[model samples]
Target: MAIKPITGMLRRQAVLDISVALGLGTASGYAWWYGYHVPAVRHRDQFYQKIEEERAKAMGQQSS
Candidate 1:
């Protein structure tokens, strides 16, 4: 007996599923590395200070 080849919608769906899986894996891997592998000191203190100031300003605006 010979193996049959996939054709039409089934083949398309298989390709789509594989592409989506690879895309998701890449995105999640990047997220994991960004969140855990990188050191906090990678960013300068001034950057964090600016973010903190912006957050405080937003909070102040919300309360007003």
Candidate 2:
């Protein structure tokens, strides 16, 4: 026996899958950017400043 596929149902399912994939991809990208990337970028200068201060303090201690 051979099975036949329905055209409209297949098309509908394909469209739904594509739309879901696109939506999830966009949402994850947005989440990653805001959750990880943005915070790192925002704190970058502060991180550098703290490191510089620590290094200066170490240098002063070494020189003493």
Candidate 3:
């Protein structure tokens, strides 16, 4: 049986694909944690306050 050699561009493309997949997986995990797990841990008032604080901080940073 003969072995086939992969070209340089193909190897580069495979590396890029793997990097993209890893990045997307990390983002999805963060989204799930914030969207579901975080809310479940807090009471209503506390949760709203946390959200408000985050929003205010973001806006403050944006304005600067």
* Winning model by lDDT: 2
Question: For candidate 2, lDDT tens digit of each residue in 1-64?
Answer: 8799766998899999999999999999999999999999889978999999999999999999
Model 2 has an lDDT value of 0.96
Minimum summed lDDT over a 10-residue window in model 1 is located at: 36-45
- Cα lDDT computed for each candidate against the true fold: 0.86, 0.96, 0.91
Clashes per prediction? 0, 0, 0
The TM-score between candidate 2 and the true structure equals 0.63
How do the predictions measure up, each by TM-score?
A: 0.48, 0.63, 0.52
**Between 1 and 3, whose lDDT is larger?**
3
Clashing pairs in 3: none
Name model 3 segments beyond 4 Å from true.
Answer: 1-6, 43-64
Clashes of 3: 0
- Candidate 3 global TM-score: 0.52
Model 2: pairs clashing at backbone N, Cα or C within 3 Å: none
The Cα error of candidate 2 at residue 26, in Å, is 0.3
Which ten residues in a row are the worst by lDDT in model 2? 2-11
To one decimal, what is the Cα RMSD in angstroms of model 1 from the true structure? Answer: 10.1
The predicted structure with the larger TM-score, 2 or 3, is: 2
Model 3: lDDT to the true structure = 0.91
Predicted structure with the largest TM-score when compared to the true one? 2
